[model samples]
Target: MSPKEENNIRVLVTGGDGQLGKCIKVLEKDYPTLNLSFTSSKDLDITNKKNIAEFFKNNSLDYVINCAAYTNVEQAEKEPDKAYLVNAEGVKKLAEICKKYDATLIHISTDYVFDGYKNTPYIEEDVPNPINEYGKSKLKGEQYIQDILGEHFIIRTSWLYSQFGKNFYKTILQKSTTEEKLTITTSETGTPTNANDLAKFIINIIKSASSKYGIYNYSNLGESTWYSFAYEIVRISDKLDTRNLEKADNYFTLAERPTYSVLNKEKTLKTFPTSIENWKNSLSKLQNKMYDE
Candidate 1:
């Protein structure tokens, strides 16, 4: 059944405790019409096919926002099997169930799926060549959804940060308390996405109930290097001066990152048309929220 035909859209969100999941939960009040069920990994293990089958058997759903993923890029290198088990195989399991139930699936993906060699913003149609295990696993999951089901939306985002989780924004804020100066990477560039912004966008998609099912890119409107992002976090918070920011070609990471992963949002803008905030403006708002918390 089409989601719009349902009297009440019963939506299920996996990875309920993650950053994006928390953002969705906070926005739940705004979307009272949706019967949203948030499920953590423990609440619903996506990797166990039998368990998922049982759960789907008991519950009826119209849509699913799959927030579950093994997002530790560096750690993914050490445990590619675990990454695939969750990101690829587990997602495949979810897609199959969604197909069986005739539910629309909305999957969160990453800009890391690309090799970051191109100088231009990445459109949805660009060929994905992931440099890291995490990206490869995510791409595999996307492929599974594409091959298995026609009713799905795969959103590829970059540099996701939020107040609710351990993200780069939080890390920078925490470091400012103890460390007088910070060194950040300037070689690599990508758009910083606020989880709340992405959450709201997802909700808009569900609310629109449009069947324009395909891949899309979503992130804050501008691009920045890690150094500039860190600088903005500190500057907006009024916690430190710009002199505290230092640039480095690289620090240390177990996984290799792309030099650029800025996603093109023209398609998304045409679809949703909500005002996309500049990364700095979003950061300032987040800083205020963090202070209030």
Candidate 2:
């Protein structure tokens, strides 16, 4: 085969309906060389081994971007089993299938894996001590991928939001329009990552096709508490005067969250030729995009 033919890659993205998945779909147009196939849960359920196996048998895949995850933090505490079923066991099955098919697995993880005991950012080598059921479940998924697949890139991100799906960014924007008073908590601290930025980064990794496979952290440059994030959103939307936004030291939540869960990106920076954007700048960009749309 010619060099161009050999370089042509077929990528399968699971959970194509999620925020990150939808962002990837939007950016797929830019990478014409990549043969990208997106699948929703209805089409390919990761939790079902037989379903995954059947899909893999019929399709030729070079890489599998596993975006399918159980992401409800508060609900996970109430139903830990449901979280593990998708986040852990489902991911384990996906990893095993990817290994069998000789395909590279690009899995999405969360910084919630850390307990947020340390004041500084968490690195790839930092031992994960998840405090919540959601975090624990995601950590188990990461562990499964590491144990089952050698060719994998497990990216752990934080506070992910975008123009699509149900996220904090959308929530704040929605609340600003409806609610007169908004009380956001300062209990948890983490970087608010733009899903579009992360989607681009993941696509860039696939384009590079580099063999440096392992866990990596990818988030926007800065950190903020939930209150600060909401304040910024209100400020940018010009809703500060009309809407009453208050900061609370603590808020009642079903799941106990980390006080700080910022992820270090030194490894991702050194490995990839991409620059990370600041949280505020990315958020502004998304806000503008939402307005334009």
Candidate 3:
């Protein structure tokens, strides 16, 4: 690597307002050696092809981390076009731009790609059989990146929650403090990943690992259903409103979520010896960090 490649690597991060994106911003300050450009949808819209093309044409990026995605699981059924446009088409556009500039692409994906029928932790090689439009669109996005760009990483994470943005922590924290009762589904099972922890892991991959250009699975250390997760969060946050706790098992509502999608992290551990925080432990730490803020 030349001085340009070694001294100050230029990095472009999309979806800077999201959970993982915001965590990356917080963590980037530690690595002042890299020239980083963070942009939300307001600065650069990934859905527009011309806007994406112009961006790549102007900037010389060594790495492009894409945190943007159409994440509304239930709403995606009503707006399939928007989901496909942003999740599928938007990803395709970004991958193409990265290929044009010969930059490494780090794309985040979800565990919804699986049909939720599996009882074990999902690995990177698991065949994706998505049920909902959201899951299908994200799976399609993954395929596009793999086919279009060779030097790219597709990290499949599950039950991602962060203190920033509209995550499970914020939602449950607010509701627990106000609601007299709460009913959460007990069927779903996956590890709740802290955005900050995952961001640090991403940074580690970029720094230490060479040619880390493949699919990977990452999340917190343990697993639990959404119902259990909500309970634990409230219990930890003590200011939780314990007045309301009901069980809503009516899957007939609309979207039928996968029963389990806990990701297997053997690869990440074997490669980097990463210290992934446990769900409850990480949740407490994340809440404390936010309260301090």
Candidate 4:
């Protein structure tokens, strides 16, 4: 994007401290020509309807990328109300305010919306059959945006990790050095997406988002299980404990996962070329990037 076009951004990323949100913050340096703004969950609480409405009324925003959500999966089973409060009702406030202010809403969602039963890559049109509280809550958020706003993009991503924030990559890397035998679920499968890639894609779409306003699936182009992801972490980070490296030990998770939640890229590919990074390719590189800081 050109300097003038970039300046037209007037973009705001909610949940700016999150993995995806922090990634977007870093990308701002590349788009320095753009007039950008960021608000973490601390800066703006989406659950408060009035805070959102007042902010939109005051700012001249061109786009609102909402990365905020109550994202604890297994935790959501017990705190359904908390999940719905932020993921569902909180997003509703975003969509509603963005509509009133004439800014497009680019909302982040998840692949967990599908019940992991589809034998192939999930498409935008697949019937949503969320089996868990997290998925259902995110889907409810999407539904609010779709029903309330005329111009919106709901990007569904899965197995996401990044260097700047707490993620599966950091968790696995930390645990690998502590546990005698790590047990991760092998049957559950999904694509892992790098946060930087997601940020770049959003910036691209926002520059000319009139055409990219719709539901799209964006992630790294392959699939793997939590077990394999953990195994790869051990391979790259030699700091991993020696006790667990002799044999591969894994198990099922308490929360039922989408055995096949890989997302199709036909929609996003129509715009920016889809990322070619495999699940492991991105994971291996992220450890170095995270360790650098």
Model 2 agreement with the true structure over 79-146: per-residue lDDT tens digits: 99999999999999999998888889999999999999999999999999999999999999999999
lDDT to native, each model: 0.90, 0.91, 0.84, 0.81
lDDT of 1 by residue, 125-226 (tens): 999999999999999999999999999999999999998879998898888777878899998999999999999899889888888999999999989999
TM-score for model 1? 0.96
Which pairs clash inside model 2? none
Off by over 4 Å in 4: 1-6, 241-254, 290-293
**In model 3, what lDDT does residue 137 have?**
95
Ranked candidates, highest lDDT first: 2, 1, 3, 4
lDDT of 3 by residue, 1-293 (tens): 12236658888989988888888998777988778889999888999989988888888788888999889988999999999999999999999988887889999999899998999988888899998999999999999999999988898888888767897778888877677777887767888888888888888777763686789988998999888788788776656644465666653536667888899999878877578878888888876775222
Error of 1 at 214 (Å): 0.5
Give me the displacement of residue 197 in model 2, in angstroms. 0.1
Q: Taking the tens digit of each residue's C-alpha lDDT, what string does model 4 give over 149-266?
A: 9889999998888787778877777777677776666777888788777888888777664555679998888887777676777888767753474333345445666678999987
Judging by TM-score, tell me the better candidate of 2 and 4. 2
Estimate the lDDT of model 1: 0.90
Q: What is residue 94's positional error in candidate 4, in angstroms?
A: 0.7
Error of 4 at 109 (Å): 0.4
Q: State model 4's lDDT.
A: 0.81
Pairs with backbone N, CA or C atoms under 3 Å apart (clashes), candidate 4: 116-258
Off by over 4 Å in 2: 1-7, 239-243, 290-293
Worst 10 residues of 2 by lDDT: 1-10
